[model samples]
Target: MSKILIIEDEAAIRRVLVKILNEENGDYIVEEAEDGLSGIEKLKKDDYDLVLCDIKMPKMDGVEVLEAVKKIKPEIPFVMISGHGDLETAVNTMKMGAYDYISKPPDLNRLLNTVRNALDKKELVQENKRLKKKVSKHFEMIGESESINLVKEMIEKVATTDARVLITGPNGTGKELVAHWLHQKSDRSKKPMIEVNCAAIPSELIESELFGHVKGAFTSAVKDRAGKFEAANGGTIFLDEIGDMSLSAQAKVLRALQENKISRVGSDKDIKVDVRVIAATNKDLQKEIEKGKFREDLYHRLAVILIKVPALNDRREDIPLLIKHFAAKVASEQGTIEKEFTDNAIKLLQEYDWTGNIRELRNVVERLIILGNKEVSEADVKLFASK
Candidate 1:
């Protein structure tokens, strides 16, 4: 239900306004105040969806009330009431943060309509805020494990500085999550964090994908295109699976890192770029470096700050906490009652070798949610989890 407050100094006008609103829309719960001071007092005491305040009242006026309300609870929509001679005051009140204003001897039609509009607008603003919060939760990192704590500490220390990071871990160990946190918690959080997976893109096209191309530069290139490095200007560019990148591409990447510039294919002009490099790989770079597949110079440049994400097997002590965290997260996403893991079920999970790490664990938890009856038991783990 929507709540509204009227702060007119005249008793007759306040009565007429309340009666019209109450009878006009029984769904609305309306309250009345004879002055701005009383209106502010009511606002502090109660939570109203919308406020209809009058200007030029005793003790305090609508403009003062509007400013105070903005400071305390800015979301509550306030509509001002003004006399014909106070039109300038009303317009000025809006500049001070009033949602809207109505002139004296209120038009019943206009007042009712404005109140409804204000309430609806407020509802939408509130709903958008709630949805954004929900989205932020879906990606929130939930853990205070020793390894997790160390990673957090490292992030706080390294994020504010402009240092190229090399994150190494097994697949699904959340190497990507760490990179994301580094970018988000960094001084460059406001800037975009562009990502390119070297393993996913074809070797022939990886150069073009990273350095862009001019129109007609290649048979498939129909128009001018900007590369990830260009797009990540004044931001961070994440190169995932950098170990899989070809030697030629790695050489070009090294040059870009050394010079802070990139030249597009079939273009002579060098494009200046300012980007923080954060690269990740599941493969052992040292092995790749030995095999002559990865460049040693590029390795040295990118490894200014090395962050190794511990695999799920290595962090078995955190299994129970991770399970509870993932379970609640899964339940919230699926809009279902959270499932509990029996003691035996948890023990069974702890014993299993999580080859795929946290990603595999999340999938396992989701499976239990869908197939397990009541509390997930030891039997469920052996049955559904593919790995």
Candidate 2:
């Protein structure tokens, strides 16, 4: 059921609104307030899906009520009620976050339609928030080691800004996790975060993949297509394995970083993009630059904030925590009872070398869970988790 509050100074108009709403939909629970002051007081006491406020009222006015409600419960949709002389004020109220407006002696169709739309928008906003929380949980960083803590601190300082970040680490050290955290905590989290694996794409097609292509630009280009840069406008684009990107593509990426623009393959027209870039690589880019495999200028442009993730071998103290986390995660995913690792089992695993880092450790934990007894033992690690 939808709860609505009608705030009108005139008793007759308030009654008509309540009656119209009640008649229009049985699910609508309409509440009334004779003045804006009373309406605000009621709002503070309980939650309402919608608010209809009169532009002119005694002791308080609709504009004041709208501003107050925005501060307290900005999610509640407000539909301003206006008289003949209040039309201009009604439009201005929209700039102040009002959902919509209805003139006095309201038109039935317009009022009902506006009310439904505002409610639908409120539902969408709520669903987006819920999904964001789920995504954050999935990408959670699970370690408290000093090295990991330093990376966390850097993220906290840099995530809110539009700065470019270069994440460097060996394969499977969770370079991608740092990128996801930066994008999720940024101002542009509401927008999409497009990920492009530079090494996965063929060197010949990398340019077209990142910059799009017009129809007939190439044999495969049958239709005009927008690329990662355009699709990531108003959000973030994460470039993984960036050191693998071709030098030709590197030049184009450098131009986009410098000018905030990109041109499609075989097209000279520049498309402006507002995207924050977060790039990661497992290779030493400085060596690549010296070897003429990477661009020095592009490296400088992307390294505004550098975060190097420590290898699992370097942070072996975090091994027990990671083993527990992965054991639980794997059990849940496979729909089996969660297993406990014996203290000897955990200690034995931690002493082993993690050449493949967290990725290798997780695979080992999953294997031990499947093959070991209810209580995983050090013997199980030797039998199932070789290397």
Candidate 3:
């Protein structure tokens, strides 16, 4: 059931609102207050999903009540009840964060529709918040090692800004995880974080993929499309394996970074974009630049903040923690209890060279969990974890 609060000074109007709402929907539990002051008092005591506040009231006005409620419970949708003379006030209240407004002696359809829409919006916002929390947990940084802690510190300082970040690391060192953390912790967290693997796309189509194509731009382009940069407007665009991007695409990317704009493949018209660029590469970009495979200027632009992810072997102390984390995650996914790793097993695994870094470690843990005894032993590591 939806909880609604109605605040009106006039007894007759309040009764009418309560009656209409009660009749409109049996699921709506409506409460009333004689004026704004009393309404605020009730709001402090109860959690409401929506508030229908009258513009002209005794002791306190709707505008003041709306402002106060915004500070305390801004999520509660507010619909202002406006008299003919108070229509302007109602509209102004919306600018100050009211969900919407209803003119005096509310129209039945308009009131009902507005209330329903507001409730729907509230639900959507709540769902998005829940999903964000879940995503954050899934991508959690799971080590307390000094190297990992330094990376976390950098993220905390720079995630709030729009500065571009260039993350460099060996393959499978969780470069993508760092990128996700930066975007999720930033102000643009609510917006989409679009990822493009530059190496995954063909050289000839890389430009088209990064900067969408208009219809008939190319033989394969049957419809107009928005590119990653355009799609990531008001959010972030993560360019993974950027060292593999063609020099031509690199120039376009540099232009986008410099001017905050991009042109589609088939069109010359520059489309403006507002995006935070976070790029990662497994290769040494300086060497690539020296070899003429990458642009030096573009490197400088993207490296406003540089984060180097340590290889798994370099932080072997974190291996035990990582194994436990991955074991729990894999077990949860497979609907089984997590298997414990014997101290000897963890030490034996840590001594091996992690050429594939954390990615390789996770695979080994999953294999051990599936093949080893309830408590994984050093012998289990030798049999199943051949790396």
TM-score of each: 0.64, 0.68, 0.68
Once all C-alphas are superposed, what RMSD does model 2 give against the true structure? 6.2
Residue-level lDDT tens digits of model 2 in 206-321: 99999999999999999999999999999999999999999999999999999999999989999999999999999999999999999999999999999999999899899989
1-387, model 3: which lDDT tens digit per residue? Answer: 999999999888888888888999999999999999999999999999899999998899999999999999988999999999998888889899999999878788898999999999999988875654343777888788999999989998898799999999999999989999999877799899999999999999999999999999999999999999899999999999999999999999999998989999989999999999999999999999889999999999999999999999889999989999999999999999989999999999989999999989999999999999999999999999985
How accurate locally is residue 241 in candidate 3, as Cα lDDT from 0 to 100? 97
Ranking, TM-score, top scorer first: 2, 3, 1
Residue pairs with backbone atoms closer than 3 Å in model 1 (clashes) = none
True-structure RMSD, every candidate: 9.1, 6.2, 6.5
lDDT per residue as tens, model 1, 1-387: 888888888999888888989889988888888888888899999999999888889989888999999999999998999998889999998888888999889898998889889988998988765543232444566676788778778977887689999999999988888888888766677799999999999999999999999999999999999999999999999999999999989998998999999998779889999999999999999999899999999999999999998888888888898899998988998999999999999999999989989999989998998999789998888898647
lDDT of each: 0.89, 0.93, 0.92
Clashing pairs in 2: none
